[model samples]
Target: MVKVTFIEHDGKEHEIEAQEGLTLMEVAVKNGVPGIDADCGGACACATCHVYVDEGFKEATGEASPMEESMLDFASERQDNSRLSCQISVSKKLEGMKVKIPEFQG
Candidate 1:
């Protein structure tokens, strides 16, 4: 399991263990982490799961796909580390990855 930490815009920290192969958005929504709407489920069509990957964890999480990268532009808070949590899968590689709920997601 991967322990994903979500640091909200207001500075609240929420951590949860995500099962391998599930999307980050799935873990957040299923566990009621708040801020991630995931309105389109795991589809890349919606930007409701938009989040900012903590710079320290960005390289480890790797870059977002071109499609996910493009959809992030539609999000309200587009940061250099902006990503759609739905597009990120969970694994040992991302065990302690940190993501911040964007100001717009709330």
Candidate 2:
């Protein structure tokens, strides 16, 4: 299992043990992490699962695809590190990954 930390805009942290091959959004939804609505159910159709990938884990998480980039444009408070969590697949390399949820989703 990979350990991923989901931090809220207000600084609340939720650490979860996520299974490999599942998306980060799935981990958040399964673990009941607040702020990750995942409205499209990991379909990458909505930006409700927007998150800021921690700089330290950026390499592991990689860049978002063109489709995901287009979707992120709909997210509120988008940032350089902003990503649609549904597009991030969990893996052993992401064991210590950290992502911050936005204050609001649009």
Q: After superposition, how far is residue 43 of candidate 1 from its true place, in Å?
A: 0.4
Mark the regions of model 1 whose C-alpha exceeds 4 Å error after superposition: none
Candidate achieving the largest TM-score: 2
How big is the RMSD of model 1? Answer: 1.5
Candidate 2 residue spans exceeding 4 A from truth: none
Q: Each prediction's TM-score against the native?
A: 0.91, 0.96
lDDT of each structure? 0.85, 0.92
Q: Report how far off residue 54 is in candidate 2 (Å).
A: 0.3
Candidate 1 whole-model C-alpha lDDT, 0 to 1: 0.85
Per-residue lDDT of model 2, residues 3-102, tens digit only: 9899999999999999999999989998899999988998889999999999888888888899999999999999999999999999999988889999
> By lDDT, who's the top model here?
2
Tens digits of per-residue lDDT for model 1, 1-106: 7788988889999989889999889989898987898888879987999988878878877778888877777899688888899888888988788889977752
